[model samples]
Target: MARYVTGAPPPSLDPAVVALLEKAETATIGHWRHWGFVDRRVAPLLPRRRVAGTAFTVMLPANDGTMLAHALDHLRPGDVLVVDRLGDRRHACIGGGLAVAAQAAGAVAAVVDGPCTDLEEIEEAGFPVWCRGLAPVTTQIFDMGGAMNVPVSIGGAVVMPGDAVICDNSGVLVLPPGEAEAEARRAIETQARGAETARRVAAGELRMGVVSGATARVTGG
Candidate 1:
């Protein structure tokens, strides 16, 4: 029932990985597709808790327990289960059982760009799942999907196996491998600058001078 390969590297490096991290500040998964991450139309089928973990991608069409079981065994703590259903929201490829298995193996959460079932069961397990839709139908184990340890596309963005995935109430964001340090630093600095501006605003800092330049920088005016 395995559809893809795991442990094997991707054919080539994704050119978009670099730019994806560059635009990390504004990248979000919502209305627009191909922002800075994959557009897995996933809803939290399990729980509404926050999810932060390294991504382990699975490609559908050639995947099954043989591959998933191995992937689970190999995955370390702080990992997120990323499954690419090839944009197919027809059936529930993953559900509660898989969530339980993944959690037992130390998975932080799961992200599926396809349909998912067993919402109640998953929620009870306290596993965070972001999926496209909900359904009881599952794949026929046709070896169509596989567990690939390479970069795979879900929604519209490419997710490398080791990238960091952060999901919250706002939306989901993917950070390319090794880019977390720099991105986090920049985000912190920008947030500090914003906080300072907020303080000034409370102290009567008007748009005449203080806020005008900042506005221009953000708006290109």
Candidate 2:
């Protein structure tokens, strides 16, 4: 027997907090020592787009997509749908129609641990999606049971509803709501420092080896 768990609605993060994270790169967020990055194989359908929002998680069975309908209804503006396909990489559980539905529901993006279909339609809809890849084969409406708004594992990272989700060209990462603001601050500082270092290097005021202290360390000078 399958189960459906509609947990409490996740709390939305402050808009300011979301904005801070949206400006930071996914790579910087991944350095927070948390297990939040989805697999590299799961990549964006459209290039150079970034999405940051609260997570609305979904868990699906191997060949069933019945619960996706329910998950769609739970979406809120600025929510990112994080779907866990339970290690079934064979069948695509989302496609063009589903992507459109999600967008209509105000979902900022969709990140799936499994494959997706109808690449052309998805791209045409302008809905950002990160998934294992494209597959002509799709899941059937088996009415098999699944869960919504529950913790799910995607690409070895456990995602909970309301967790901060950031997706970009680098990959997808989920941050605990409590840690998002602090981590965003750290990433911002890091980005600023990197930019200044690059500027100095470009002007010949500093060298890569001097900036990184690698030359002296390696040569024991």
Candidate 3:
């Protein structure tokens, strides 16, 4: 087989769509959808930061980072590099250099199915990465066959190049472009409603159980 298998970069999501999705928290979305969430094992390096963007995906070989460079080369603004490590959680293919490179290419963030290294450099670069964890061992440009801009799995979530990637402290969520807009809109409305409920409780106009419906359910009133 060829040393590398790749495809053209998928179309990017509209910036307006991205803006809408960014404000919609994954936890809020979780209340409605049963799927499309990345495994909890994969988490954010900076939990406080939230980002939304188009998925620019790559299937990286277990210990080879050759395809990563290609993926970076093609990354456009507002893209998130979603890496499938082929189940190699031991070796980290992403580190300081790749983080900086991808950020310079206008990537909003990256999601990896495995570990990553160079924590100091990555933090210094101020890039957000959702990954398994930190590792001392790293991958190399071994030229093993890999693919870019194609469908891949991250944390058991199937991600495509054009998918909508929303990530934050909670976890990473991938959604089809068409579905993303509606989901984000719903989540936003739900968040507003939730906030209003919290406000009433804080104002002493309602109790916690009353807000949650537990009071009625328990009292049968």
Candidate 4:
């Protein structure tokens, strides 16, 4: 196999769609969706801000970060670097320098299937990252085999280059391009309705169970 295999980067997503998707919280989308969620293990460093972007998938071999470094150059504005660690969890591929590079290149966030280093740097850089966790050990520029712009696995989710990515405090959600707009629109509407329901409940005008049909179910039972 070639030491480094790369494919054409996926087309950038529409800014309008990304904006719409960003407004939809992952938690709200989770209510109606059961699939496409990244594994719970891949947690975020900065979870307060929500972001939506296109998936820029990369797969790396153990102890190698050559492809990742190269991938940074290819990142477009609003791209989310989706790293497939290929089962190596200890070697960190992302750090302070890469964070800045990605930021300058217009990457909104990253999702790593493994650990990363330089927690303090990442925090100071204000770069958002989601990964297995942190590690002291890191990857070197080994010319090990790797792939870019291809379908890769991250935290139990199948992510393809150019797939829609919705990330928030709750977690990361990947969806096919065709489903992003409709699903995001649904989530936004649901959240709006949920707010009104909460408002009524808070005003003592309604009960939680009643709004959710739980009261009727229990009463009939």
Most accurate candidate by lDDT: 4
State the lDDT of candidate 4 residue by residue for 1-221, as single tens digits.
44787999898889999999999998898998999999988889766588999999999999999999999999999999999999998899999999999999999999999998898899999999999889999999878889999999988899989999988888999999989999999999999999999999999999999878998999994
Clashes of each: 25, 0, 0, 0
Worst 10 residues of 1 by lDDT: 10-19
Off by over 4 Å in 3: none
Residues 1-221, candidate 1: write the lDDT tens digits.
32456575322223344333333343222323345455535555534545566778877752333455456676656677888776566767677888788899887778888877888888788878888868877765454446557777876777887777766544567766576556645654665676787787788875535465776777677
Alpha-carbon lDDT of model 2: 0.89
Give me the candidate number with maximum TM-score. 4
TM-score of each: 0.72, 0.95, 0.96, 0.97
Ranking of all candidate structures by their TM-score, best first: 4, 3, 2, 1
CA error at residue 142 for candidate 1, angstroms:
4.0
lDDT (Cα, tens digit) per residue for candidate 2, span 1-221: 66777788799889999999888898876665557777788898779567799999998998899898777987999999989999999999889999999999999899999899999999899999999988888888787889888999989888999999989899988889999898888999998998999999999999999779899999998
Candidate with the larger TM-score of 1 and 3 = 3
- Measured by TM-score, how close is model 4 to the native structure? 0.97
Cα displacement (angstroms), candidate 3, residue 136, comes to 0.6
The stretch of ten residues in a row with the least summed lDDT in candidate 3 is 1-10
Which stretches of model 1 miss by more than 4 angstroms? 1-4, 8-35, 46-49, 62-66, 199-221
lDDT of 3 by residue, 87-206 (tens): 898998899999999999999999999999998899999999989999999988787879988889898889988999999999999999999899999999999999998999889998
